[model samples]
Target: MGLDAFAAACCAIPVLASLLAVRFAYVLCRSGLPPTRPRAAGLRCLIVLGSGGHTAEMMNIITELQKDRFTPRYYVAALTDSMSLQKAQVYEKSLIQGEGEKIIKNAQFMQIYRSREVGQSYITSIATTLLAVLHALWLIIRIRPQVIFCNGPGTCIPLCASAFLLKVLGLGWSSIFYIESIARVKKLSLSGLLLYKLRISDQFFVQWTQLQQKYPRAQYAGRLM
Candidate 1:
């Protein structure tokens, strides 16, 4: 084929793939009832705890969850982030002491590699994101939790993508709950934008009413923190 024809064919392939992907995602979203409504106790919870503000916001959301109902909660964070782990430990301790032993005993901390370290180059970030996605895929396969939760964070992108793929393939029943960061007043952060655009999150939550108004598909239940 001519050069122009070859280029057109290549472009057509990706266009077709994109259309198929969007169709598959839409089918997955409409396949069954919503995933957030837990029907039984001991629902395994996998939470992605991003560093800094993301961690604090997720902690607040976790507090709203019934500690007794969601058993064996797993917190996933980036390997380079020690602060988020520390905060998670404190929260786990509180859950144990206040709610029961399940929180302390069953709660696990999963540290995946950072998708983008401080001052990393764009190429390096892309490489690390691929690695993070692999790790996230394996982690999700291993745990196969009923639900996965995360707020706005770069790290959550890979995990959310993995979960979305899993749902699309019917490989797992894991639902993704992505909450936009409270700091995002005008618009969604990078991670939130990615998840929302791809429709990866089964439940997309926003902290501000304006955000919800902007993105009608997202749910807004007031301030999480």
Candidate 2:
């Protein structure tokens, strides 16, 4: 109410936030996943695809997952990124042809607004991120994916954040796996940094062993591409 009281309250905000963050980190780290069990067919997955290099790396990760394991895969990217969507479709088609009818049932695509356009202003980027969050939240609610996968890119941030919020709210139990870009051998990209610091990702994968050592929790699972 008074100046001194108000100042003290404001000062306490950061401390409260820090304490909350520590608790969150503890819960996330201690909440290790349940033991692996034999799963029947049809595990839903949601994969976020960024453009160009990001898309390629994500595709490689999906390929390594083995088409038989994850079923009903949903690929999401920027609405304008037709190239990435098309590429995903083609890959899905190949799986359908190679694996027969099963793979066809699992492949789907959804698009969200781009978090930032080329050379967009910070204000515009923020607006776009809000829109992306709304879209991501809607998709997560409707699809209720078992696991969500993404690699480093600005576009993936909103979706990953949305997934984290869902987890916090106990609305979804979707595991989030974030793989740092292969290009980021020494340090994480901005997006990767945010996800890691926020402790939103259940598993973080790095291509290089050095990064794994740097971020001890991150798994070094070889090169994505």
TM-score of each: 0.82, 0.82
Please list the residue runs of candidate 2 whose C-alpha ends up more than 4 Å from where it truly belongs after superposition. 1-27, 30-32, 35-38, 98-103
lDDT of each: 0.82, 0.82
Give the per-residue lDDT digits (tens) of candidate 1, residues 63-170: 889877777889989998889988988888875545654547778998998788889999878888888889989988888888788888777888778776777666
- Superposed Cα RMSD, model 2: 5.3
What is the alpha-carbon lDDT of model 1 when measured against the actual structure? Answer: 0.82
Candidate 2, 156-182: lDDT as tens digits: 777777777766656766778898989
For all candidates, the clash counts are: 0, 0
